[model samples]
Target: MEVQLEQNEKKGKAFIDKDGKTLAEMTFSMAGTKQLIIDHTEVSDELRGMGAGRQLLQKIVDMAREESLKIIPLCPYAKSVFDKDDSIQDVLRQ
Candidate 1:
């Protein structure tokens, strides 16, 4: 599944769509140009336990790195993922 992105002005999301239905997504707000405020994440029942949340997080993480930006994981799930994973911490905003 490919992660798609949609953004307008202040907010945006990294999402996966399967046959026109969203399977998973991570939403965020643009914090100026140097930071991203990741505020929420959700996965469909079909994607539960399949790492869909992480997948969406990774997509945003990669975007952050590419843009030389940091991420503040305000969402509980996103914060939990950032807490457990040391490898992705480079893009995290402390």
Candidate 2:
């Protein structure tokens, strides 16, 4: 299976798909020069507990690192995911 993710700026959406079917979607807004406020993350009911959230989050983190930005997770789910992820602590806003 091949998964693809892309930013849809018009809709303020991040789409995650596997073989053309969307598995998850995340919506976010820019908070500032280096901060992003993730509004929500929703995974397909059938895809829940399948690690798709982790994959989407890792992609978000990678994008933030590449752009030299700090993340301010406003969504509870996002906050929870990063709370125990020490690897990304360095890029989190203090």
Best by TM-score: 1
Please provide, for model 1 over 1-94, each residue's C-alpha lDDT reduced to its tens digit, 9 standing for 90 to 100. 7898888878999999999999899999999989989999999999899888998999999988888999999999999999999999999987
Q: TM-score of every model?
A: 0.94, 0.81
- Which parts of model 2 have CA positions greater than 4 angstroms off? 1-3, 8-12, 18-21
What TM-score, to 2 decimals, does candidate 2 have?
A: 0.81
Per-model CA lDDT versus the true structure: 0.92, 0.73
Model 1 misplaced stretches (Cα beyond 4 Å):
none
Per-residue lDDT for 2-22 in model 2, tens only? 334455442255667766687
RMSD of every candidate to native, in Å, equals 0.9, 2.3
